[model samples]
Target chain A: MVMDLHVSLPRGLTLANPVIAASGTFGFGPEYSRYVDIGSLGAVSVKGVSPEPWLGNPPPRVWETPMGLLNSIGLQNPGMEVFVRDDLPFLREKGATVIVNIIGHTVDEYARVASRMQGEAGVAALEVNISCPNIKEGGMSFGHDPEQAYQVTRAVRQATDLPVMVKLSPNVTSPALIAQAVEQAGADMISAINTVVGLAIDVEHRRPALGGTTGGLSGPAIKPIALRVVYDVAQSVSIPIIGMGGIASAADVLEFLLAGASAVMVGTVTFQHPGRMQQIIAELPQVLSRGGFRGVSGAVGQALPAASRPQTRGGDL
Target chain B: MAGQQFHDGQVDARIVRREEVARDHVELILESPALARAVPGQFAHILTPGMLRRPVSFSRIEPDSGRVGLLFQVVGEGTAWLANCQEGERLDILGPLGHGFAPPDPSRPWCLVGGGVGIPPLYSAAAQWRESAPDVIIGARTREWVLMQKDFEQLGLGVRVTTDDGSWGQAGTVIGPLQEWLEGHADGQVFSCGPTPMLAAVASACRGRAAAQVALEQRMGCGIGACLACVVPARGQTQMEYRRVCTEGPVFLAEELIW
Candidate 1:
């Protein structure tokens, strides 16, 4: 019997599987092609790109925590022009759907980037990253407020006809509100829980571990939080949800699927195992077969236990 | 480029050897036949159970005995646990990952400098450069942080030490003493592995005097080229081209690096 776990997204975007490489962790996609077959996976999310070139943070940008790692990489990347010229061409040669993660300081920046990729041949989708703290704007994070999320999403949506995915930060109080707001503002899909804000203390140096003092937390420590956020947002948003955080194994991917994500992005887990995407893709058939599921859509939201009373916690749905 | 073997729950052997100089750091002598495949500057991915793989550079590979020795300090949770590993216990190590330091010149009077934990790789390079009897400079933040002085002395080479608090050797950073040596020894080759600032200072000190190479310490995920996590900026490159500390090098030419 042939095993099948195909999952589909809107605008005729169909995937043989539901696993995608989270942005940043999988550098432009082709690098992993040397070790694993890139085209077999659902899709490849490229590194985060900006309107202008970014230097990232200083040395010691990452610190390993108990179960995860904290990184204040400051979204280091080549500007859009370099990415299109030097990197994108290489990715285009690889037979994988390339999802570009775009970050911006302002709505105009977001729209400007989207407009550039509007009719690009090889580009599949655009992931709007509004979770970055504006360096010139006194550390204000763009995703914390719904108005900002709506404006950024709306601007990009208007500029490009391509599918738009909004990557949300779990540091906010209400992930559902942000999810719903972006959905209403015209995000084709949503990727939940970028990373929770956290810091690590260096006992030897008697100071904060990360160079940036504070950083975004990824890896196993944020898995449960990511699952909760994905579950909460899935209920509120009509758009397809891309759940991510600490997804490692095939079982972890299934957890996100049952939690209501149409697709799952493997983040910190990929760091632990660079060849993880292929391992996850290879295991999906057996996992789905064991669960008696015909396809991935049948598995979506299937494991959500009878929606219990919403917890009284602040910002929880 | 070699083959990889899968050992399931193998009792990977480990032994604690007395430090030739300092007590804060210990050398774990690995007995795995797999370790024979190690490269000069490549490191071992030590498995310490609760923590992820902690990268420790190969201080020396006893080629005949298949004994691969790693010099490490009691730094984080992984190193702290590694410091306590007793003889006969096994360590889960996936090894010799990344490009090691470049081969040293046998003709010149080379300078080998290390500060604190970064001193590990230099020990191996020093052993390799024994024929040349190179000049050495070792430093730390304080006297207590100073590691492996006696080992440097045993090598019978010119050894200099510096501590910020002035508890040992010189009263300033390694650059001050290094600059003094470079001023007189016009044709020496410089090799160093230490804190970023200290190595940068060494690079700046030897700017036009000598060719300097430094081993960079960046937080790594896979000590292989696979994960782009351990990237160090390269000089003269736009888009901030980086060399993977694991794959490209934990060691690089000082002039080629942006640091």
Candidate 2:
């Protein structure tokens, strides 16, 4: 029983599998190459890149919770120029399907990064990051407001012909509204959702554990919340959804697919087990077959309301 | 990239031995051939029941035996769980990761300074230098808290033990003995580990007197460089830059650190 795991998105982007390495968790490709085969992943979404270099937050950046991780890394990167010069060549050489996750302090900065990535070899798509909770300016702020989210998505859409994915934050009251706004503004896909905003206190120090004080919670703790957001956003938008939040196993991937995510990104669990993504990809087919599904497309949106389920595309067994 | 010869990968190492080294400090020996290439200050990212892997430096690495030792104090839920792990149980570990201490110049007099839970890597360093044993100083809050003293002495290295309550060999911190040692051997090199405050003081004491490299401890997400979580401020070209403690170092030159 051969189970097909391929996924196809808008703008001619097609993945060999539905498992992608989430942005920020997997560095700019080289870090995990020793532990994981970079080319085998469906796609490698590099860390969020800004127009200029970002130094990120201070010390004590990550704290462990029960089945969760809270981090405030603040989207630190070497800027677009260095990324295009140093990182892109490496990923291209590795035969990886690259998804550049773009971020900025303003709408122009997001577009500038998107435009810079234009015609870049091996880049399959652009994931617009408007939902990073760590940064003080222009991150989650744009994601919370539907108008700002639409504007950012529109700018990135104009800057590049590549498929654009607007990452949604779960920190808002209505992530569905934000998803609808981005879909209206020409977003080809929606990656729902980003980490949930949270905090941890150091009782000994009488202060917050993270350098950014508050961080985005990830890992098994946010799976249910992520499914809810992906399910909600799937119902609100016509574009496909890339689901992520504490995704640890192949079974979790199917759950996200059922909740309306066409593909899933694996993050925090990679820290605990670096080879988890590869393991998930290998295990996905077996899990999918066991769940009475022939392929990933068959499982996508299976749990959604009958009237709201989007038309399944790509490989269906 | 230089001096990093260890091939890092995930291994399910079976616990070969477990010993109570000190009060609340447990030393577990695991059969991990992958860590055979590990140098003095390199560490292993061990997965406990917790979400994040704990980065514990190598206390002992015996390549011939295919066994590595981890000496850690039971601090939180993670270490406490690690302490309860019995012999013969397998542990999921990723290592021997990170750059370690550079080989000390044999011509110059060198010393090993360690405090509290920071003595493990220094022990590994001392074992490597058993042929030409350097001066060793191990400090703790109390007499019972001092660790690996007999292990150093057993290796035929002279060990200096210090305690805060004056119940041990030297009263107060390792600074008093360290200052006297620096006065004696001004051209010496110092490799120190333990608490951040002790490292700061060691860095201060060695200024203009002896060269020093100190191992740092920080809460890490991914014990690899990807997460950018375990970072320490370092002197960069124009301004201070955050360096990953897991990759750039758990071991760094004292002068290179911002504080």
lDDT of 1 by residue, A1-317 (tens): 46666767877777778888888777766555655567777888887777787766655667787888777767777688988888777777777787898877778887888988878777889998876432334123668889888888999999988989998888888989988888989999999878788878888899987766787788878899999998888777778889998887788888888888989998666544455677777777778767766667767776565562222334211
* lDDT tens readout by residue for model 2, A1-317: 88788898898889999999999999999899988888999999999999999889998899888888899998988899999999999999998999999999999999999999999887889999999999889988999999999999999999999999999999999999999999899999999889899999999999998889999999899999999999898888888999999898888999999999999999988887788888888889989999988988888898999989766655443
Candidate 2 root-mean-square deviation in Å: 3.4
lDDT of each: 0.75, 0.91
- What candidate 2 gets wrong by more than 4 Å, as runs, is A312-317, B1-8
CA displacement after TM-score superposition, residue A146 of candidate 1 (Å): 2.3
- On lDDT, the candidate that comes out on top is 2
Write model 2 residue lDDT over B1-259, tens digit each, in one string. 0121122487788999999987899999999888867999999999887899999999998999998999999999999999999999988888888989998988899899999999888989989877667999999999988888988899988888999999988889999999999999969999999999999999999999999999999988888899899999999888888899999999999999999
* Clash total of candidate 2: 1
Q: What's candidate 2's i-RMS value?
A: 5.3
Deviation of model 1 at A196, angstroms: 0.8
True contacts kept of 1: 0.14
